[model samples]
Each structure stands twice: as structure tokens, then as C-alpha cells.
Target: MFEKSYDVAVCGGGIAGAAAAIASARQGKKTVFIEKTVMSGGLATTGLIYIYLPLCDGYGTQVLFGIAEELLLASLKYGPGNIPNWRIGKNAEEAKRYRIIFSPASFTLAIDELLVNAGVDIWYDTLICGAQVENGRLTAVEVENKSGRGRINAKCFVDATGDADVAHFAGLDCPTAQNALAFWVLEHAKGAKWRLEGSIESVSMHADGGSIDKKRGMSGIDGAEVTKFILDGRAKYLARLKKEYASGNQSRTTLFPLTLPSMAQFRTTRHIPALYKLRDGEDWKHFDDSIGMTADWRKSGFVWEIPYRSMVPVGLKNLVAAGRCTAAEEDAWEVTRVIPTAALTGEAAGTAAALCADKGISPDELPVTVLQDALRKAGNKIHLEDVGLAPKK
Candidate 1:
């Protein structure tokens, strides 16, 4: 096996992984980003989940900032989406929410550009096979690519695999949740009047054979389960198209799938049971160690302070979890798994990893205030009051 070294090694290349790699590299660390596939934006781009949710509380204030906002704007650079002038103090109704619908391909290109600009060493089509842990600290990750097996030794690591692959590899206790079936595809339909500022339109098949149903769900962590989930989703998509054609209302030429999701659209998989798990009904709550704030994308006037403790996995010294694998449960998981919160937590984890590497310390050994200060200096609003909002009385 070949040997390599870096200051920070970010596992996974999705939205969270991209943000982590960029944040670490920007902090002057030698960072390497590893991805199992060629694409960058994970589910957001490859899974056809292209909506960049919201950055605002949905009432009238913008809550998320830094890389979350940067990626949202970047998503539109090569795609079709618009950001309302929310910075000018227009209300949500008048200015519209801070969100956009982007082309997945375009967002992939933009993410690659951002990664390159940040001086991140990127390894595409590389799969993480194992990890090396010593004295309760992660040391290096074993990976395989076309170059064969190799070991990437880093001072600190960020687990952004969405499925908690790194933490699981390190023998950490990771809890999982079932995901409802959802298959979103981009199609070209003749006279598709409700197109989303693009020539093509997105169509979805949900769990109950409808669109975006969440009742019946299944586990996504097992290998066979993943295979069946994908196959079952495709079968449902095929059934939908067959019905459309049989009705004599649409034909292959009139309406057909332009692109299918290259990855499974499972919403939640596995996550670390961190030091602090953000649970349901914590909306508008305050955390003294909050690294940043994220709004509830599903509804307006609801926000949550993301605790730095939530990213720190127990019994691990140099590893922090981000994105869907963070310590958020139930309704909180639904909020943190989206694009905005993924980037938010990704940036925080990456910054913390860099700080740990620089100081030759572990993630838990580092002070939360130091991490919070670094994040705030990078234009992130760490708490509710930082954005001129307060917890509900």
C-alpha cells in the first residue's frame, strides 16, 4: 500500500465534504478530499436533490451565512436559480425566501471550481475501506482507487460520508434511521408549463406511489438494502412512465426522462451519537456552545442553534462528524440533513479539524470558544442574537 500525509483528510465529497475540504484548505492546511464517485455534490447533485433549501428563518431574517450562503450562490453560477434581495431588509413575503432551484450538473461544476480555488487535493473515484485508530484517536484512513490501496495519514479527520462510514469504520457507535422512497428525475416534457426557470422539469415518485410521501420507510445502511431500494425506486419510475404512455396523453417524444439520479435518494441513513444530540422541539432554543444557526426549511419562524458539541463524537479524539451524520435526531435530523445545514455543519467541522491539526490537539481537547471565534471571523453568525434574533420566550 502507498502512504500519504496531510494536515486534514475529509472523507466524502458531497456538499458537506466539499465544504469541509474547502474550509480546511482555506485555513492553510494540507487537506485531501476523497470521494467514491466522480461527482462532487453527493445527493444534492448526483441524487437529483437540487433544491438548496432556505437560509432564512422563513419569517424575515437570514439565519445562515458563510459557506452555506456561498454555496447557495455558487449553485446558481452555472445553473438557473435566483436569490431574492433579502439583504436589503425586505420581508420574506416581499423579497422571497433565500433559496434556489439549481441544475445539478451546474452545481457540480461550481463545487469543483470552489474546491480547486481553495487548493484542496481531491481524490475522485476513491473508496474508503478502513481506518486506523490508536488510543481512541483516528490516525489514518485506508482507501482504494485505480491506483490500488493506500493509506492517507492526517492529523485530524472529518466524517462527511452522510452514512457515517468513517465513524462506523473506526468502531464508533452510530445510530441509523429509515428513509422513505423518493426518486427525483429530470425530464423534458412538451408544454411543461410549470418549469422551474429551466427547459427541463423535475418529476418525483414518492413512497406511497405518490409524490414525496414519507410514511413507509426502510433502512439504507445495508448493501443489499441499498441495492433493493434503488431497484425498487427505478421500478416505480418505470411504472409511472408506462401509465403515462398508456393513457395516450404522453409519448416518448412528448415526455421522457432526460436524466435519472445517479445515486440513491435516501434522506437519512446513519449518524454518530455525539456528545449532544439535537432533538425535536428545540426550535429557537439557545446553546452556549453553538457554532452556528440553521433555520427549519419546512416551515417559517423556526430556527435552531447548532451546538459544537453535536459534531464531536465521543471516544474519538481527532474525528468530527458532519452533514447527515451529525448528532441531530427526529425533526432536527430533518432540518440538519438539508443542503444549507449540511454546509453549515461541514464548515464548522472542517474549521475545527484544522484548528486541532494546527494545535496538535484532539477535537474534544480544543476549546469551543476558539472554534466559534474562527467561524465568526469567517462571516458565520454563530447564534440567534448574532443575526439579531432571539429565542422564543
Candidate 2:
């Protein structure tokens, strides 16, 4: 039962949400970053995701910049990873992609430091239960914390919850996709040789874990279903450990899990239906509202321009989305729901949220040119052509 106000309020403290909050606060806006978890970096930290995908096109050049690149380099402070040598030619192997493997705990500390240095008001262990809207604009978001239930009033909001929690609560038709069961855990393996040839040693360190497939794929929507998914994953993990120990392998007996993913590692569960739905085969397509550029980490030479419209849920004023829940069709979800893309979209949405709040305008009505200019000033390449990539006919 309290009330507070900010110029921009970012929900979700994942990579996307952290980036958004940083961008907004750096602009001198009164910004608040709220998270359901106590830590930051979302899937990257809490979910035990050890990879910071890539910021480059496979063609020997960087495609993503700004906060995306900043965070990537920041991850190396306490973890292992390397920046791609711009002179290196196209890389066919994923190991050669301009990516890095980071320690989840290390990343959590780094991101927390980043937000604090940027002067963002961070509220951990806070859950956004609902949003208040009037005349088609989001007014405030209702939240529950140890203190009690209250509202965070803001002129603008960024939904970086990775599940579109804010957008869904706002009554948008967010779509859900089937998620295959995969479990990632951090564990200690004594003297494990973890790096590949020509890889950075620091980035190659990770826990010994495996993926498990269930007969029925996971759809993490209802509380009961999500709980089942967690239990099943843990059950599979335990069974494997038991089998390995019973085999009389001394090494297996020494293995122990340091941490399980704080959140389900479901890559894609839900996304907001945005003004523009990014789909497959639209690679290198340019949009007037392009906010930034991203590359498909799974492949080489494929690039896509992320439209500002995609972050703005249709008919929702003063609200934008970032991370996995940003608007994208199921096919495009594979690209959009990764570490790099989440940071990219988060930077755009956060910057946009600040600008919209300062100008007293709705996000839908914010001029594309103004937004693009601001993004470019931040060192983001908004078009593939800007990165020397040609659009395919």
C-alpha cells in the first residue's frame, strides 16, 4: 500500500530489462527497474545460460553495438570470453562466431554493478501483477513486494520480462509457442578440460550438463504446468546422476550441481503481438522504423533489422517490450529470443521509453526519425547496409 512515480519504469531485471533501465537512466530520466528475482541477467545468470551469443554478422564485422556490445565486453570482467578479431573471415562453425561463454554468477554481479553505476532504481523480489490503463495508455503497474501491494506510476514502461508479462496483463493477444524440454545446470567438474581448440580459456568453462526430452513438450503458461516442467527436468537430471554414479565412475561421484536455472530454460513461451511481426525470410529487409540490426547466431551472413514498431504492442500507448517477449513470429523467435537480441531490443525500448516520457507523447506517435537518430547516436547500426551488408532481392 504505497505509491511511487518514475519517468520510465522497466519491468523484468533480465538482460533486456537491465539494458533498458540503463539506457533510460543514462538519459537523466527517473527510471526504475523491477525484477521478480533477486538477481539480474535473467536467463543469462539465473537460468545458468553461460553464453553471450554474438554481436557480429558471420562476415567479419560487428552488426550489433551500443549496450549489446558493452554488456558482452562487460561479461569478460569476471568470466572468460573474447572479442572477435575484425580481421577474421567468415566463420562457418558456431565456435568461431563472435560470441563468449560467461560464468552465470559472475554475470549477475556484473549486471548489478552496471545498473547501480547507471543510477537506476532497482527493486528486486518485486512481481508485476497487473497494469493500470486509461484512454489507451498505460498509467502504472501494480506490483507486490515484501512491503506490500502497490503501484509504480510511470509516464512510460518497458516490458522486458521475457514473457511479456506486462503486455499480457494489459490485455494484448500475446502468443505462446511450444518449448522443448532442456535443462542447463552449473556444476563443478574437477579438472575438466572445457575449451575447444582456438577458444578463449576463460569463456570455455561451464558445468557438465545434458538436455532431456519429454514425450510431451512444455508449454509454460499455467502455474501447474510450469511446476510440472521443473519437477520433470529435475527428475531427469537426478536419474542421470544416479546412473552415472552407479556405473562406478569415480569422476561421476565427484560431480555436483552448483545451481539449477532459477527460471525455466524454455527458450520461447510467449511474445506480444507487435505493430510489426518479424518472420523468417525477411532477412536484411529494411524498415522505416528500424531501431537496430541483429544477426542470426545459428548461421552465417544472415541479418535482420529490428523495427521499433516490433517493440510497441499494437494499440498500447507509452509501453514497449524487449527480450524474448518482443514481437516476433514463432520462426523469428529463434533469433529474437537470445542474449544479443534481448539486449538490442532492450536498449531500443528503454531509449524510446525515456524519449516518449520526456516529450510527453505516446510511443506509437513518436517519430521514427527521432528515434533512429537517437539510436544512431548511441552507435547502433539501424540497417544492414550500415554494416556493409546488402539486402537480398
Candidate 3:
């Protein structure tokens, strides 16, 4: 098998992995970004989840910054969407929240450009199949692509796969969650109700149920389960199209799917049990080791300080989990699973990995203060007070 080396290896090319690779490369570390698909942005772009989510606390303040905000702005460079009143000042109205809906194709192009500009080595259509661990530290990842199997050795690794694939392969205890069946498709129709701004396409959503429950949900970790889940979602989409055409309101020429999600739309999957497992009801809580802040996109006035410890999985050295694979529990997972928080944690993980590599130490050994300082230097606001806010009473 061919072997390569880098300062940092990032698994997954989604938003989180993209942010991680970019952050690591910008820190002057040699970084390699691995992805199973051709495009970046993961669910945000490929899964038809176009909403960038809010970067503000939803009250009147911007809580998230750094690469999170950078990716949000980049998503618009090739798309037709804007955050009204964003530059002027904060808007308290929920409708005016700091968010934008971008075209998936356009955002993919923008992020690809950003990755190249950041000097990140990108391996598209590459899947991570295994991991190499020695003395409690991850040393390399085995990958499969058209070139056959290969191994990538790095000083540090970021598991941004959104499923904790790297951590799981490294023998870490990663908990699994059930995901409700759902499908989103981009379509074009005459008199489309959900048409995107400045585009001829509209997005439609189909779901098996409103809430996720064990009875009606499936795990995304299993190969067969993932296959079934994706098939079920596509079946739902087919039924919807059939029903729409049966209504006789539109013809095939007027209403047809323009694009379907290139990947499964599982909301939650596997996550490592990190040193600090962030749980629900801790919004606005302070953490001395906070890497950055993320707002609850579902509601206003709720924000959480993301701890660096939450990204460090137990029993793993030189490896950190980011994005949806971070250690978040229950309601906390819901908050951190979105696009904004993914980018937030991804940037933090990448920076931490680079720092660890530079020190020739594991992530658990790197001082939190060092990581925090680096983040702040990179334009990230790590604490509530940094954004002129305080812990919730």
C-alpha cells in the first residue's frame, strides 16, 4: 500500500472537516482532508440542508466567530442570499437572525476554492476504512479510493466524519443515536412555494415522522441500517412526487426533482465519550477551557461555551473529534449538530491538532490556555463575555 505523511490528517470533507483542514493549513501545518464524496460541506450542501444556521445568540448579539463566521460568509460568495441588517448592527427579531440560505452547488464551489487557497491537500472520493493506533495514540488511517488502498500518517487526526468513524476505528467507546427518516430534494415547479431566492429551484422535505424515537428511527452506524435508511428516504421522496403528479396541479415538465441528496440525511449518529460530555440545560454556562461559543439555533437567547475537553475522546492520544461527532448529549447534541456549531468545533479541533503536533505531544497533554490563546488570535470569541454577554441566570 502507498503511504503518505502530513502534520495533520482530517477525516471527512464536510463543513467541519473543511474548517479543520483549513485551520490546520493556515496554522502552517501540512494538512490532508479526506472525504468519501467529491464535494465538501457534507450535509449542509450535499444533504440539501442549505441553511447556514444562526451565528448569533438569537437575542441581539453575535456569539460565534472565527472560521464559523468565515464559512458562513463564504457560503454566500457564489450564492444568492444575504443576512439583512447584519453589517449594520444586531437585529433582535428572529426573522432577521444572522443566517443565510445558500445554493448547495454554489457553496460547494466556494468551499473548494477556500480549501485550495488555504493550501489544504484534499482527497475527494476517499473513504477511511481503518485506523492505526499504537501506545494509545492514533498514527495513521487506512483509506480506499480508486488508487486502491493507502495509508496516511499524521502527527494528529481530527475525526470530523460526523459519525465518529475514526474514533470508533481507533477502539474508542462511541455512543450511537437513532435518526428519524427524512428526505430533502431540490426541485423546480411552476408557482413553487418554497423557491430559493434568485433561483428557479425549490426545496421539499419528506419525513417518516415528526419526532425521532427508537421505534421509528434507525442507527446510521450499521451498513445495512444506513442502506435501509437511505432507501426509505428515497422511497418517501418518490411517493411524494407520485402524489404531487396525481393531484393534476402540475405536469412533469413543470414539477420535477432537479437534485437529490448525494448522501444520507441522518441527523445523529455516533459520538465519542470525550473528557467532558456537554449536556442540555447548560446553555450560557461558562467553561474555563472553552474553545468558542455557539448559539442554540432552535431558540433565541441561548448559547453554550464549547469546551475543548469535549472534543478530546478518552483513551485516545493525538486524536480529537469535531462537528457532530463531538461529545454532546441529548439536547446539547441537537444544538451542536448544526452547521454553525460544526464549523465552530471543527476550527477548534484543527487548531488544537496543529498545536499538539507542534509540541510533539498528544491532545490531552496540550494546555487548554495555549489552544484558547491561539483561537483568540485567530479572531475567535471564546467566552460569553468576549461577545458582551454573561452566563444565564
TM-score of each: 0.94, 0.94, 0.95
Error of 1 at 295 (Å): 0.6
lDDT per residue for candidate 3 within 285-310, as digits (tens), equals: 99999999988877777889998999
**lDDT (CA) per prediction:** 0.87, 0.83, 0.87
lDDT of 2 by residue, 316-391 (tens): 8889899989878755777888999999999998999999999999888899898888889988888878877777
Q: RMSD, each candidate, Å?
A: 2.6, 2.5, 2.3
- Clashing residue pairs in all predictions, respectively, total 0, 2, 0
Give the range where candidate 1 is weakest over 10 consecutive residues by summed lDDT.
Answer: 201-210
TM-score (C-alpha, index-matched) for candidate 1: 0.94
Candidate 2 clashing pairs, residues 3+ apart or interchain: 80-202, 80-203
lDDT score, candidate 1: 0.87
